[model samples]
Target: MSETLEQRAAPAPDGPEQVRAAPIGAPVEGSADEQLPTPTRRANPFRRALAGATEVLGPWARVVWAAAQPVVAVVSGLGWVVLGIGFLATLAGFILGWSELVFLGFVPLAAILVSIAFLFGRSTFRISIHLNPSRVTVGERAIGQVLITNPGSRATTPTRLEVPVGFGLAEFALPAIPKDGEHEELFAVPTNRRAVIPAGPAVSVRGDQLGLLRREVRWTEPVELFVHPETTRLHPTAAGLIRDLEGLVTKTITNNDISFHALRGYVAGDDRRYIHWKSSAKTGQLMVRQFEETRRSQLTMVMTSDSRYYGDADEFELAVSLTASIATQVIIDQVPISVVTDRLALRTHTVTSFLDDTCRLQLAEGTFDTPRTFARETTKRLPAPSVVIIVAGSQLEAQEYRGIQRLFGPDVNVFGIRVERGARASIKDVAGMNVMTVGALSDLSKVMSRAL
Candidate 1:
């Protein structure tokens, strides 16, 4: 017998059947044989054509781009603008029969064509750059010489050589060079500040006076001129503050050390080697030799690069100078020293390399926490140091200075130098750290002597 449509569609009474509504735009659950309506839209003819064309012409477009790179490189921005204007003007003049527009366009077109002539000759001269005494202290004179030699048999045309000295460019005009002829030109570099200045890979530039076209041929590698921070010579005793072969004695008592303090009753974990037999016999108990804890003198110098701590550039420079002076003395004394900034560590194996790294030191926005936290995190990765020197600008608050002192243990001697221009040099104890304030580089030695 055939059942009615309503009866067939009704749910069975197996358990009160539940019906759930499907979300909008979601597919509804149905039998495998069920058919669903799907709306269809026709593809746009323009997009289809574009896709086909892009697929077919992609390789050819890349080939054209590769071919046009050199032409685009040689033409200056102004030259391209002029070329575009000339083409547009010429086209409009012919269409509207205007002779004035045609003549105006022809003038720029002719100028560009003639300007290309300057770039026609190849640069055949061998060029080199020499910086005498590549590294110098601040305020010292640095001389850089460019040597251009005509290595070919034929005489070369006149060209201008451009050498990039720091942020400025130095141009040298060359006369026509005969075969095997050499030309030398000297220029002075400004070393008024401590920095690492890059001076040239000398490039021969061929360009028109109007700057419509330019071609450059690089000849030599760039050389770095390190203008190191001016460091003051410290007294021999200054090294004593940072270096100690026999180690510095602290008040903390320990079972085993070189500096003998007293005899104490032995603890459970005490080493037997430190047990004093004579003291044990007299006291009738296990007594060990107590020592005034001695620590190997390893200096850690931390220079803060955070710009917020500095009142001015001079203060930062003074801080750097003071740090360099102290670190340099330690290096010369052959002491184990580690110099670091908030950002990274500086190489302090040799005086030259150390100063060169300092030349690259720059003030940057800090990403870490306070100076104390930064020093703690930085020094933990290195060997435990007995002496930690914190170099910062005067803007650092007194509270921050105390926080740094508290970061180290009682045994470690912490020193802080706050550089403030025009301020009298003075030293005071803050939270067990000897903090010194200095106005100039010369004040460093005096304050350091008193602080130690």
Candidate 2:
């Protein structure tokens, strides 16, 4: 009985220790929770008020910013001056504590305001630009006309029009135009270089008398001027070792052929339709038509864009001119010619289009295989042997050309024209290939005259 009473009165083993330890709900000093750094962001009434105001005014601020972007883009050099002067005047007024200078600051401010008002006004004239003969040769002239028409019922204001040509700008002062009147300005485009010149959307800039705060408005669309490579006159028949109209003809007989080559003594199985009665009566023997076996009358012109083959940029230009001259002459003669350049090929259709395509041709960026290989690969796909003409730089080796000859395989009359710096234009026969080296563009016609 005493043992049962002592057991009930005494505390359990863990009861005292559990009571001594604080409950989870009670806070403890120097715990992990207390040791951590406080968060940088804390609730602030002032910041909350500012954010609430910003949310309220966000749409109006966005509207103002949207209106300012175009004005910033159109601002000219004088516009920047007005802005800087106004800013410095305001700053000086605050620093010096002078009321007069503060008012003086309004001078530039008022000038800018007036300039903005003038520039942002509605355009008074409609502008249109036309490029006459949009495609021209390198040395030919391209005419540009900017026509400004006053379409409004009232007289249009005098303004300045600027058009971008190549890398420069052409400016003109437009006189005050009557209602429903038009003014045209004529300008000559520089065609010294072979390139595509971009003539722009006419920009009309209106500014203050003090040259402050100008507004530029685009009034027309852009036009491209394609400057073609210069080419000399080459006679159609003066192509290469072979004649233009006929290829290599063989001594063969055919009953039906387009070309009347010759009449031959009639043999067994001769077609009666081909029997020449006049020749038979004169020779006292049956005569029949014999057609000369002819190769295909197709000319293949291969051009290389390999920089290694050229000694300088001038050499490349001469090569292009030579290619163009030959290609033009062949096309003019109505002989089907295939032109293969480094980055382009021409489908000999129109002289104008061909020249335009040649103008667009540019040299390849990296190294490439021998142009002869390219020529052979291109020729293999053709149905018949062609008179192959290759135009390249002078850096090519004899073995490389021999490789080109091997690539053409057989039956192709291959001709090469190499342009080099500090060299005279002359022709040479290299390993059964006729090659001409030309240093100048004028000598092209001379060389062809000698070769053909």
Candidate 3:
């Protein structure tokens, strides 16, 4: 063989010149056991000391901080501002020997003492609250009644009552109640939208006319007023795709089932009991029976309440109304239905309860996986239904529909409704899943009629 220039220039493998020809950075082969160990950097002593100190004093320091939190809160408000100014003025007046400044400072000091005394007095009146029809629909009225009773033998002095409703407070002044007497106050419940309004832990606030020394006494328990989403009439015939209990028999064949489907030529290994004797005699061959496949028509509604799934709060409200309309119509149809909304599986015992749950449902933070994935997993654990309807926000794109399609096999029918505000309503098939968009609540029935 002819020696190439490159080969001639290469170092000899088994020669004494090889060691001397090795490059400065060239690696020397060694057995795994003989290899040098990697070096580790030393940790700083200061960091170690800091970690040790944290471990020792962390719990006690937390306890002391927690103990001082209430004190800090009490002095953190405007009360502290007034108290600080008064203290500084009093000190300066004493130092300067100014009688007018001293008198001025003493006035504030006296006011502080009186305010403290006012805040410290024990509240004598007992309060109880009652909500008429605690759950109501939007545009409906709910009355909240507050009863103040004097439980003690002695007469109860009149005081101001403060009840928080939504973002505002309703105030009332009570008259002096004789021994064992009671007084009642009624307030209107605001129903601007679907919400859970905290009626009260009736707070009685006592503050000086100067807006100093404000104190609150909680006399009643807090109650929730659920305002359900308003729903329009959505015909069940248009909304439901399959009939409940006994739906149309599928063309697919099953070996042994309840419904009598069809008859075919018997194979050698076919079950002998299923053979139709009359048809065999007429055809002069063994005929086997085939039963039509039928499934109990059940509806599953998966609603997404994650804020990230919606373009805005209005979109979410539209989604909720759409869900409520369909679900309400399904319940009216007397079909088995399951409603799942972001992490909450609503109880479907009654239409009213389900509506209540929808009313109380709030937008939740998004999870690591999308809402569709969560719905798919939840559906898998449930008994497979004949129809699956997903009510998602308009934020879902065609790609998400592809992901959602993998959850159900071809045997079941799946429908998707994307709700948007002020958008045109339309329906089309996306990745084998029937999808529709609803712009308004009333448009749902029309859209479903076209889609179904």
Candidate 4:
């Protein structure tokens, strides 16, 4: 909800309303609903109104009276002499002892009726607008539609109505209704970008026989459209295992690999399948079948997004992109990565449902915001055993250095990536850990290829 109507009824000390808002078309308490902006067709806005009176009056219906204003003044001026004649007739009626009042009243009554007859169309109508795909995937198309209906018993006057389009939505106008009737139209929506698309409003004017009295009716039906950013592909290849970092892709199966660890001596209650024949023959002791550890590998990913050039959009957007890519990779690789952030889960482990769309995310200004996000998130968890990578700004950072050592442990490698604003970023190792960092988005393909 925006500010209350009372607060916005007038300008404040700051001046006019900075953000523009469309007006409500009907009463708020009415059954009418809000119009969502959608994509649709284009119709010429200035078409003329089409009423029975318009056909009779032709193109000059609205202006006929105005165009003939001078002639009307002349005629009406001469008609004043009829008032004198009426007075004399009334005087004569009085002198003849007949009623004078009736004679005087009929002249004025006839003149009033003639004046009313000059006015044209007399129908009432309502306009309805609709927007489709109220919500959309990034880059998906949205649509809009407009409907006009005459809600009267009598036919209409010659009228032209213009509907506004495109603040974020498009607008169209319809011609006047001859009798009671309907009209429809369309337009387009820009995809995946966040914006407040608004359609201007409509303009309708009614004509009279004299054309002197024109009624310009303004309509305000507002619609808003929102565009989310598109989904992009991530690094295709797995990263090479860095001796220093936590998350590296390596082929060698060991205590660290997600595969089988080894076989051991069988104990009481051990299943018969646990006995190893070859090892039993050599050592004269039974060895149980070895299996890989089912436990999830511990992972910690730190991102410092303060690039010298990363522009001002949504800090959270980039954070989300990076987090989604990394988190998904961890799950796919069979590693359980935990994300650190404030105000979310105190701790995330074992790649639970929490990691799905809600990857620990934080968007802020400056380099420390990244580390701050991490420090704030990992409150309850034990230290991790898998690789640790810190993706930060292109510039050297203090927290990156401190965070690496603070989170460091056995077999843990920490790596850093520096991103320059508006330029290609690459993954590079800042600490002894294989911490991979990139400055440019263009180099993403090359960096990703190495992992494959």
Judged by TM-score, which candidate is best? 1
Show the lowest summed lDDT stretch of 10 residues, model 1: 1-10
Report the lDDT tens digits of candidate 3 across residue range 24-52.
12332211111011211112343344346
Give the top-scoring candidate (lDDT).
1
lDDT of 4 by residue, 357-443 (tens): 242233344434555445434433645545555545435464455555465644444544444444544443434434344433445
lDDT against true structure, model 1 = 0.75
Candidate 3, position 344, lDDT = 78
Report per-prediction Cα RMSD to one decimal.
24.4, 28.0, 24.8, 17.6
lDDT of 2 at 244: 45
Candidate 3 is scored at a TM of 0.76
What is the TM-score ranking, best to worst? 1, 3, 2, 4
| Residue-level lDDT tens digits of model 1 in 79-103 | 7778878998988999999999999
Q: List lDDT for all candidates, in order.
A: 0.75, 0.67, 0.69, 0.45
TM of each candidate vs. truth: 0.81, 0.67, 0.76, 0.44
State residue 424's C-alpha deviation in candidate 1, in Å: 1.3
> Candidate 2 on 1-452: residue-level lDDT in tens?
00000000111233211112122223322111010111111123433444466567888855765676565554555556667788798889989998888888878888777776667566678888888889888767667777889999888788877776544456677788899998877666656556666666688888876766566788877787778788887654465444545566545545676667887888898889999999889999999987856665777787887777888766777777888888887777777778877666776798888887776666565445656566666666655545777788888775566677676536567778888866887888887777888887788778877876
lDDT of 3: 0.69
Q: lDDT winner between 1 and 2, please give it.
A: 1
Clashes of 2: 0
